[model samples]
Target: MGEPQNPGRERGLDIILASRAYDLGFMSDWGGAGNIISTLYSAKSTNFASTWAKIETKARTELANELALFRGLE
Candidate 1:
């Protein structure tokens, strides 16, 4: 009989596929914007993943700050 598949591995693969699809759609719609911003900022590389990580980090930090402020008001 064939070996059983690992559910963890299957889930990981699914996540990777979804991430790739998202990246493709994002690039298709805003790919040129990245280039323009990079040029304006004098960035040497237009790495999508790096830019996305920075944006996500900023968003999370902002959200956390806002939540903390709201909680203090209570």
Candidate 2:
């Protein structure tokens, strides 16, 4: 994907969304550290509850992708 117009500002926004996602993830006891971190980094701050949902979905997708090969071996 292409970078934002202002990468520095976009990075700051990512950090803000990440912190929020981390708190939500911790409170919910969801996913492992890698998933949590990935969700945080990938989250977009469109809204509060919706953003959490997005993070959860992203985390689950990432986890499934990571384990897809193992699952297929079953």
Cα-based lDDT at residue 22, candidate 2? 44
Candidate 2 stretches with Cα past 4 Å from truth are 1-51
Cα displacement (Å) at residue 51, model 2: 6.4
User: What's each prediction's TM-score?
Assistant: 0.30, 0.26
What's the lDDT for all of these models?
0.58, 0.58
List of clashing residue pairs for candidate 1: none
Candidate 1 off by > 4 Å: 1-51
Evaluate residue 57 in candidate 1 and report its C-alpha lDDT on the 0 to 100 scale. 57
Q: Give the alpha carbon lDDT tens digit for every residue of 1-74 in model 2.
A: 98658858979988998886345434434344334444556674335455456566666765676567569989
Model 2: lDDT equals 0.58
RMSD of each: 10.7, 14.2
- lDDT of each residue in 1-74, candidate 1, tens digit only: 98787879888988998886344323432334334455436776666566666565555565566568779999
Error of 1 at 46 (Å): 15
